[model samples]
Target: MKLYDYPPAPNPRRVRIFLAEKGIEVPTEAVDLRQGAQLSEAFRRINPQCVVPYLVLDDGTGISESIAICRYFEALQPDPPLFGKTPLEQALVEMWSRRAEFEGLLAVADALRNSAPAFKNRALPGHDDYEQIPALVERGQRRTKRFFDVLEERLAHSTFLAGDFFSVADITAFVTVDFAGWIKLTLPETHINARRWYETVRARPSASA
Candidate 1:
């Protein structure tokens, strides 16, 4: 079994951090996305979807998507329980993880993809080429700012997004917070709670993984 990764990408970083936190190491092959390596025929055969953070199991089962890959490891090693321990905690982690993806990560992605020259005809990821929407850039920026506000409020009341323990929710949110910086979007100084959460998560050794 091996993992396909592009270290600089946000999604792959999520999986790396997850694996590091779990203390599980998988053989990894880097697919350089910057040079359009993912579109190569060789990689397309491995992952038809043509995205990184993909895992190919020994039996040839391919798992794409960061959360799905993380889930595999969570099942493989249940200790430390990044997904969460109790049923309630699991549900909450799932909920907040989705929020981090949809509300936080996707928002920043939309803004970046729609406005950056590197993503010119690729507003969305995949095999198809789609033109960037100038209007969505503004809308995405607005949504991302709101995401910060939401996180600030949530962080103020809980030690982490899912509560007292660090879990997948925190990982997703932490990655989102960093990904936002690519588009030059950052947490305002006034959002102390969110900033505090960012600092705490950034300090983790797994964060560098």
Candidate 2:
């Protein structure tokens, strides 16, 4: 198996950290997002979506989307059980994972993509370019702050995003929180629980990946 990746991108980082936690090492080819390498015809042939963090199986089947790739690995190696251990656990993990992606990651991404000058006409990710919406940028900033507050409250009672055990929910949340730095958004100093959880997760070896 091989992974087409790009360092510094939060989506790819999610898969990289998942692979690290599972102790799986697959050959990787870096895709330079900043240089628009993903838009090249060569890369478009592998993934017409023109995105990073695409994985190709041994059988030559290509997989896009970070979460889908992580799910594939989870099925391949179940010892660590990053997704969940049981039926109920899996449901809860999925719930929290979706929240982390929608309320957290997407908020930060919207703000960054629409506000950052570098992403001027490329507000959305994909082969097609989209213009930034000023209103969306403001809305995104507000939503991002609300998401942090929600995380702070949730972490105050639960050790992890979904439950006591660290799962994909935590991984998704961690990457989103870290990515928030790009938009100058962060957990408030008063959010002690969130800060504590962030620090603990950041100390993990997989977090460094």
What global local distance difference test value does model 2 have? Answer: 0.93
- In order of appearance, the predictions have TM-scores of 0.98, 0.98
Q: For model 1, how does the per-residue alpha-carbon lDDT over 1-209 read when each residue is reduced to its tens digit?
A: 99999998899999999999989999999999888888899999999898898999999999998999998889889988998898999999999999999999999999999999999898998777899999989888999999999999999999999999999999989999899999888999999999999999999999999
The per-model lDDT (C-alpha) reads 0.92, 0.93
In candidate 1, the residue pairs with backbone N, CA or C atoms under 3 Å apart (3 or more residues apart, or in different chains) clash, namely: none
Residues 1-209 of candidate 2: C-alpha lDDT, one tens digit per residue: 89999989999999999999999999999999998899999999989999989999889899999999999999989969998888998998999999999999999999999988889899999989999998988888899899999999999999998889999889999999999899888899999999999998999999988
TM-score of model 1 (CA atoms): 0.98
